[model samples]
Target: MGVTLKDVAAAAGVSRSTASRALSGSALIAAETRALVEDAARRLGYRPNRAASALRSRQSHLIGLVVGNLVNASFHTIAEVVQRRAAAEDYQMMLSITDADPRREEGILRTLGEHGVDGVILIGTGSNAAASNALLSGGTAVVNLIRGAAESAAPTVLASDRDGAGDATRHLLELGHRRIGYIGGPPGTNSGDERFAGYEQAWRDHGLPLDERLIERGPFEPSFGSDATGRLLARVPEMTALFAANHEAVFGVLPALVAAGVRVPDDLSLVCYEDISWLRWWQPPVTVVDNGARELGELAMDLLLQQLERGRGSVPQARNGRTYRVGAQLVQRESSARPRDV
Candidate 1:
């Protein structure tokens, strides 16, 4: 017969309940007893059935983490931090990638729900309110990361996109770049809107006329970045600096600049939003406004832990949806400089 708790208890010379408590690391059991029970179980090759224990305790000890995609460096940091934090707390993390598609997000949420995850941390697509709320209404703790869904009541953790973009714009402005071009993300996204607003605010702060012709808004794809760069260069040939607010777009921006025979800082200075490792190694390096991805991930885990503590299967009371913002900082590098003419 397979080794069981009863066999372990006999070997440890204790009652079955004592063996169970000791193996489960219950603090109520004495240190010495726990050691004895652990030793006995190891010697007898007895393993506790986690599924049976979860059934008894009503906690799956699992957390679900959903992200738009792993391509963004910020998402990569968030996944690493959340996974480590969940492990430290004895919770298994289940990760899902949704490509920012609402339908995919809905399906992932439903699957996580079926798995009975105790809580979820996700970069919401801002269009999956129904799926998210259904989980929350059923007592599953949910914490939104990065983008947020307005209709969902879940707490959110985000980087200060407005402040970060403003910093990038101001940096270019300070460097004597009068005609600065901006490449940014799509309109409806929270980060995209806030970043664009910050750019406009910076121009207003500097008393400069906001030139609408120098701005391009599109997807985070390299093709969009290349196309936007072409349009800006063609439309505003005198543009002295470019703030590539979309990180993914920077990839396309650099290649397009090269193809156009534009030299960094000499002909055109550049500043990008969000820091990734490769930015520091690029020829001449790249200046960036760093949105604190690591800090955002850590804070998201903290918020989810708070929700988990409120008890499983209990809905949170109605209150103003709370958002926690991580600070952003500008990391200066070789890519930005005073315009040659200035």
Candidate 2:
């Protein structure tokens, strides 16, 4: 038989009630006494029955984390960070992968709700506002990460995509590349729209003519990247620099560049958004704008905890919206340089 609260209490010379309170982390228990009880419990290997505790407190101590896909390095980092943070807080995390499908995301949200999760954090599919709102209305706290649903008012955490993209564009512009090509994501999404806006804004700030023909936007896939690279190269053969704003697409972009016999920082300077370990190991290590994936995950967890502590309904609604942003940084590498003819 496992060690029980009675055994721990006897070991600590405290009552059974005191041992239970201390293990539950009650504020009413004196610090010294609580420490003593906890030490005794640990020595006795007494594990609290989470099922019994949940029955008494009505808190499952479980948090649900949902992401579109793990293909994006940033999402992978965010998932790791959040899981670590949740475990540190003594909360178990349930992870769900939806592949960015709206129907799948909606079903996951509904199932998480049915499971009585204490809270939820998700990279929304942008089409599941109704399901998210239902969770909120049912007194469950929801925090949106990376992508925000248009109709839901859940607190959101995001990286500064616009600022990061602008910084990347400025880096290429500063290197004397006027004819720059851009490969980006589909329009209407937060990252896609804001990143393109940032690229456009940087050109305007530099007083350079924006060339529409050098831009390509499509799904975040390797095939899209390869096809887009071919089309951009054919249309703008004189393009001296390229910004691959979609990290997933860069996989395809690199192979296409190799097939075209383009040498990095020589034939065409390249900059990518989002940092990954392999990026630094590549020949002519790729330059990138670091999106602060870990920081974004930490901030998202913090916001969710705050809402949970305040009681979801008690969290004051923001006048506009509660959105937190982690800043982006530019990391230079051997992949970018001044245009050869410049």
Candidate 3:
């Protein structure tokens, strides 16, 4: 016969009940005893009968992670961190991509709920207000990640994007770049709006006019960067610097800048709204506003787990409502410099 719980307990020199408590992650069991039982289970190749365990616990031991776009660098890191955190608690994570499509997000939310996910962690603005409200009041634990107060009704964790963007934009202004071109995601998304607010706030604080002619708004597509940058530069020839709202757009902006004969920190200084590793190695390393995506993911999942552990209203909230804001910082690199006189 294959190794069973009894066999594992016998090997660990502990009573069956003690071994069971250890294996079940009961804190009442001593740490040494838990380690010993885990070691025995590993050596004996003892696998718990999940079906029976599920019947006893009434939990699927599964979590659903929903993201607007999988290809986005930010979501990729977030998903990785979520999976790792979920697994540590003996919970498995299931991923769903909505492509930021409202209808698709709506359908997927229903699907995940119907499939009996113990909890959900969603990124970006939810699909529809009705659906979001339904799920928020549906009594299932849900933690919204990466969205701001305007989009979230339940517990949420978000990057301090407005502050990050404001800081980066201010840096460009400080470098004496009078004409700064801005490229970002469409206006509907709370994230995009907040970032734009940061850019606007910086100009307001510095008593500078934000030239509407230099701003480009589009979908969060890599292609958008090139298309918009080309158009912006062609129209506003005096524009000396560019700011992109997300990492994917940076890829698009670079090729367009190259084609236009613009040299980083020479002919045209540049800064990115989002930071990723490869940017550091670019010929003139890019300056960026880096909000720790991985940390955000970890903190978000931890909040969801807390909700699951104690049910709704267990997680703490601020005076106004439920929101956790992760901070961001500006990374200065060679990509930014004072504008050269046209």
Model 1 misplacement above 4 A? 1-7, 10-13, 40-47, 259-261, 312-318
Model 2 regions lying over 4 Å from their true place: 1-19, 26-52, 314-320
Cα lDDT tens digits, model 2, 244-341, are 99877888999999999999989999999999999999879999999999999999999889878877763335432378899999999999999999
What's the number of clashes in each of the models? 0, 0, 0
Q: Estimate each model's TM-score.
A: 0.92, 0.87, 0.85
Rank all candidate structures by their TM-score, best first, as comma-separated numbers.
1, 2, 3
TM-score, model 3 to reference = 0.85
Q: Candidate 2: lDDT over CA atoms? A: 0.89
Q: If both were scored by TM-score, which would come out higher, candidate 1 or candidate 3?
A: 1
lDDT of 1 at 333: 96
Better of 1 and 3 by lDDT: 1
